[model samples]
Target: MNEKEFKKAIDHYRSLIDKEMANEKVIDGKFVGPKKLTKKDKIDLEDIIHPDRPFLSKDAPEDLDSLYVTTFRVGNLKKPEVLTKAGYGTDVIGGIEFGSNLVKTGLIESVDDIAPFLAKYKIGILDLFREEEVEDGKKLDIRVYECIDCAGMPNIGEPVCYFETGMLIGILSELTGKEVFAEELRCWTSGYSCCQFDVDIKETKKGLDG
Candidate 1:
């Protein structure tokens, strides 16, 4: 990730922690709701968050859409892991392009709203956060339990949910009309109970301006 993306992510994390603090919890050594503030700076929140944080080291990937695969085989893709973002861009943005065409043809609503609609065709639940769950100007977090790609695949020992991450960014950017970034923070294959992704959404005002 670049500097701008890094800053946006860090700022969102701080706000997430802030929300937790509001509920009266000692998180990262700070209290906000009813407890006293122990230190001026706890863990120096800014110092801990940065960009270019690589989590995947998979040697290869396979694109599932390339074939008329079965229901059990979705979200699969093949690509060199070195490119980092290539597989995701190809899959996610390509899906958006296809969805856009459908919308233009009056076959669907919009690219942004297509996720939940398409979830029926997918293997796992693509749970997106409701508007009330997120405050304005903050990043969006999504979860996918029993993800099609990672759940049944042989354990790869790391997060390989990049395609879903990219899909989320594409969906939101199509809806919000702003450049957004998505990162997979956890994956079922990575030993997490579910697949979790973080997205740096476009600020509502900027999206409105667009």
Candidate 2:
């Protein structure tokens, strides 16, 4: 997309996010938080695909600038719920494809390699506490220290690394050859020293019988 088009897209997204945040409230004196977007309010699938490409283009002068964690934290200050969903939406639309390519290209060859690869790329320092076979598939307890998304961020009362959670989902799904889902169980923004994810691997039909 061209500069004007990219700016329009970003503005449109912000409008939607603002609308969603508008419904936020306090219940029993506790913050209700940003409301979820309904079907009509969601960002279109096509728009979510590679939404970062515009920002990543070398030809884009804005690309010369780097966004700090504080910038994101400030954005999340009032719209954590919507922002989290936006991150997940990006993953479902294209982040998975992007992450799977890491394995497809031999960058990540095994489950044991995930941590080192993450560290190599400065994504985070990954720690695998344990993995166990569940009834249908597997469960992994994973932690990330110095998480790019929320490390050193002040307590935000909720987990705020939906993007990273989705990244792990994609990476693990490709690495294990199964459908994987990950949930952010803890985060620095939620008063944790590290980010923790509970990953669930689902057995496919082929794997079920194999």
Candidate 3:
């Protein structure tokens, strides 16, 4: 997409974030937290066709530049409630984790074996709607990643995919012409599990504006 078009898309998503935030209901007087995959939890992700790899955590370099957004969802395969309540389909075949495994393993493995594993895992998207009550000027850290769909590639690192983040603040900033704090953006990689964006969101903003 062109620069203008991409900005418009970002703006639209930002509006969604705002609307969701404003309409959010308090359950028992507590704001909700975004759904997320912890570093340890993400390590066990398995695919049908690819061999699993040990978890890798890389400290994001400070000098890198990129624009990122924070968003949230639960990402375990075992919980059906996590998927259904979040409005994601539990029956949908070939989700991000499935694709990641396919890309990592060079084989087009049977979908049946993978189905059971996926059923035990769930990616919670509802957590994104949960907000923590923070004093004005308080800061939070947000994680971001890119989602890639490897088309018949066996190598874990070779596939091209889409990127996503759980940072609602950044999305709102882009939509509302405001600035989001840099420290709020965190980066992660879910190899063969989902498409993750690794670049800095701050750098991306500079490029878009330029």
Candidate 4:
């Protein structure tokens, strides 16, 4: 499809998804931690597909980027209410872990140069940004028009994708050679049409020094 037509298609589909998402009751409380797991609990859990696997599944969509986003989102969000119950801390940790995996792929070298790489991950829809100066660091931003995490899912009232947030921080930290902290300030889950993440850097001057 032509670029104009393709954007239209995305807008139309997201319009419907936005409405459906409104029906979700946003949560205002913290995640209820899952009961501490036993070794057997971990062992007994069946090995389902990795969250990123379906992107390459035999029946996967030819549109690699979109397919990967949707599949990765759907696969991970399958039981978010149950899964996130591990607590918000888990989200950041998981984001870092997953981000580490992405780092291993070496697609994105630095936060300032993340656009093209993130586009590959999503669909050329991520906007990379750098905010004002900091006392001892800098702020990085990523604004997304179509976030897969909350695209089709019901809204839950707060930023529901710390995984992406922390992942960004971790990746940027490696790229910039600085300790980075990231947070989701807004979300589609809270009725926002887009998702924006802010990053705080520590112990480094602005710009991609790493």
Which candidate wins on lDDT?
Answer: 2
| Candidate 4 structure quality by residue, lDDT tens digits, 1-80 | 33454355346535643564454443455221112212222111122122222111223455554455555655654554
Q: What tens digits encode model 2's per-residue C-alpha lDDT throughout 1-210?
A: 344543443454345434533555544443333433233332232322221322223343653312432344354344455675555566453656767887889998888777668655546657676689999888988877656566654445566677678778777788777888888766555544567778888887324555
TM-scores of the candidates in the order shown:
0.48, 0.58, 0.22, 0.59
Candidate 1 per-residue lDDT over residues 102-194, each given as its tens digit: 455554456444544544444344455433334545566665544555543322334565556665665566565666767775553343445
The superposed Cα distance between candidate 4 and the true structure at residue 49, in angstroms, equals 18
Q: Give the Å shift of residue 143 in candidate 1.
A: 0.8
Indicate the worst ten consecutive residues by lDDT in candidate 4. Answer: 41-50
Model 4 TM-score is 0.59
Q: Looking at model 3, report the run of 10 residues with the lowest lDDT sum.
A: 63-72
lDDT of 3: 0.27
Which ranges in model 1 have alpha carbons more than 4 Å from their true place?
A: 1-112, 130-136, 204-210
Question: Each candidate's lDDT (Cα)?
Answer: 0.46, 0.58, 0.27, 0.53
Per-candidate RMSD, Å? 14.8, 13.6, 19.4, 9.1
Model 3 C-alpha lDDT per residue in residues 1-210, reported as the tens digit of each score: 233533443454345445534543333443322223223312222332222111110122431211111111223335554343343232222233444444346332442223222222211111121224344322333221122112111322221222222223233334333333332121122122222222222322423543
Clashes of 3: 45
lDDT of 2 at 26: 46
The model with the greater lDDT, 1 or 4, is 4
